[model samples]
Target: MRPAPSDLEPVSRTAPADGTARAGRSLPRVAAALVLVLLLLVIARLPWAGDLGMHAATVQRLRHSLLDPGNPLVDADTPSPYYSPWTLVLGVLARLTGLSVFVVLRIGALVGLGLLVTGVLRYVRTLSSHRAAPALALLCLLLLWGPLLFAWSGFLGLNSLALTVSYPSVFALGLGFHFWAWLTRAVRGTAAWGTWVALGVLWALILLCHQFTGVVASLGAAAAVLAARPARAVLPRLGAALASGLLVLWLWPYYDFFALFSAGADLEAIHRPLYEHLAARFGLVLLGVVALACRARRDRRDPLVLFFVLGVLVFAAGGLTGHYSWGRALPAALIPAQLAAALETVSAGRRAVRAGWACVLGAALAVGAWTQAGTLGYVVPRDRLPAAVAAKYRTPWAGYQWITRAGVRYGDVVMARTFPARQIPAYGPYTVAPGYPDVFLPDADRRAAAVTRYFGGSAAQRRGIVREYGVRWVVGPESLAGPGLRKVTAGPGGQVLYRVVP
Candidate 1:
């Protein structure tokens, strides 16, 4: 199945006819392209916070020293994989910039997007000599940005990066791809010892940012090995890359790599039709798959083809398992690989066919841009808190404003309807009863159930919830403010805050 070395040479080297273009004009074009990418990312991110509440709560706790040194997540303090070092970086940036964490996150996301573009370009340069290949690839990625699957998955490593600032997986994906470009060079004996060390540090950083992204990177590297073939030439370098990745696990012994697999098993019982489950991104995905097949047929040794194959596997894994995150890694690899294939197809085609394909790709990109704009329109369109966040805690508007004015302190337990229980902790320092939102916690479900009963059940059940959960205060609409509770505050909407009697 291996193509002759001559067929592979064009992929690895610039065509002689374009050597002058590569030498004289490439730098200017590349610089211009990067600037364009950065600007687009900035514009796309003007509206922020897709799911800002949970992550904001975590950052708030850490930044304000509300968290115990040992605990990172606010209500659920137990050690888990979600405590991200990148979150700390964002917190520190907020401190230094004197900006809202939201603003800092937007800037940080833009930087991550830029790095991702650079990584894609480097990776594409390794597999194709076409000067416009990198630009075309990035444009395609941006055009795909606003589609539901890509946006929810963090804009497929484009300008609309990260579903929210709190989740660093999207940013980590960018770093992971950048790391892959370096690893490929190392594996091919083209990178220096320093480059290998840098890549190792990069791997460690990705693990700290999000463990799942690290897993995705490892899979991509495996795909690269398959594309390289003839193990002897690349084995030593591949070993170096593998060793670098493994070194991180050794250093971070607390990392429970198997933990998420078990946790994700919970999703297996829930099923949806493949198209609906994939958010209707299947058509674009099919096009990518077909393009990759064509690229492979042209040259089986084309590394781009293998990379796209791995992307499809990741996308399919998510669909099959009902785990959206499993396929979240698709954008980083798929965007560049698909673009390269498209460019190659256009270059190899007859005049009429080439123009038709170009127009099709161009139109797809335009549609994606419009989709991105509309999607972001829904993200942070207004200055006020989102209705989703507002509805999380159905406190009357006046009652919640009163709590905010009263300065709800850290660790203050408030008993209320536990529907969307993350609200109080997310918006204020006060802890809520049934604090455990952890999937891994053995008592989480029971606690949630008990809290639910307290809100709607008889007075006897309310007392049991208070006694069991150490209820300090009860907050709700006035009608539920029964006996043995001292109403400390009242609101125009008939909401009340009552202190639970001893």
Candidate 2:
């Protein structure tokens, strides 16, 4: 029987045979570049929203105390998962350059975006030598998701990437793509022991950088390895690599990497949202599903199909077992499907089929782009946008910089509502309770109760709560005034700042 048409066809056949075709191929590349530049500009703005404050606070702590940054959210000396290898490097940059934490994050965003773009190109090249494959794959990876706009750290939809470009998730994901590419090449050829060990170290680094993306990376790597069906001789090298990676995870000093496994219960509530609106969130990738089915028909060991299957199993188990944190692994399935769709469109043996796939993909991409058009509000004035686009834009949260400007110093404990609590730490002050969950902070529940009492309890109880936590400031509405509280200033959204008077 004849072998199936090689997905890894030579560049000559993949590239356009004529000037017009070459121009057509070049168009997508140019569009991809423009999209990247727009993302960079969005990074420059660094709109404040979910987890940005937490990350900014993490950098601030690391900048001040690299080895002992403590808990990023509350005023406590505890290890935090946010103190990963990538954040540590950013912390050092903040300390060395005397740049603000947000500026450091912008720099980090540029680096992450560079890694992601180049990594995608390299990994896609391993699948298809087509000159346009990388460009098309980039476009698909960024835009090929369901019509509903979902923004999360690990998800790579255009709107999501715009919001989370500066996050460690992006950095980890970039490394993940490179990991898949390297693993693919290593399994196919002879590799030195040192090379395998280095790969192990890289894997550990990716895990430490962003644990969720690390899960996705692990699944992809496993797919690549299993699809290769390595010889007996390669098993020893694979073992060495695994051992090295485990060693790194064990030796990590900032936090107990294994401790995170037990913290899943605390995280499941927040992650449940990941499973909602599945069809609206990922419907566009069905095209890729078709592509994977085609590939699987020809070769049962197809890596993308294996990766998707592994991701689905983990995700389904999460939904069934109330381990919603595992939902973060959805990207592991989505990415391969998205890439497969892009590759099959360009590499189909017949012109008619390729054109049909391309037309479908092109239409899907256009719809996806419109769904995420609200991201343009980050670069352009929302009012200037068309009504449809403007309506899609969700305003970012205002920062708590006013309280900081009013003299709330580092380590100052502020009693605030949940919303303000989320943003205050970015400016160096800690809230009475953490804005997000804290697995390591032993007094999280008590702290939360204290915050609640301060807000709604009797005056005497409020005093007791303040004395217990050493609260120096109170942030709330003007109606919150009392004898011990003196108004300092007002903030956005009618938030009043009050200093505790002895």
Off by over 4 Å in 2: 1-17
Give per-model CA RMSD. Answer: 9.2, 5.5
Report clash pairs, candidate 1: none
lDDT, candidate 1, equals: 0.57
Tens digits of per-residue lDDT for model 2, 1-502: 7655675365547565576467757977998988998898999998887888888999999999998898998888999999999999999999999999999999999999999999999899888998889999999999999988889999999989998999999999999999999999999889989989999999999999999999999999999999999988999999999999999999999999999999888999999999999999899999999999998998889899999999999999999998999999999889999999999988887978987888899999999999999999998899899999999998888798888889899989999978888889888888889999988888999998888877888889988888988899999999999889999999987889999997
TM-score of each: 0.73, 0.96
List where candidate 1 sits over 4 angstroms from the true fold. Answer: 1-50, 64-76, 92-100, 129-131, 145-150, 154-166, 230-233, 253-255, 267-279, 314-337, 349-353, 376-403, 416-420, 427-440, 471-479, 484-502
lDDT of 1 by residue, 96-143 (tens): 666765566566667666677688788766666766667766565555
Against the true structure, candidate 1 reaches a TM-score of 0.73
Tell me how many clashing residue pairs each candidate has: 0, 0
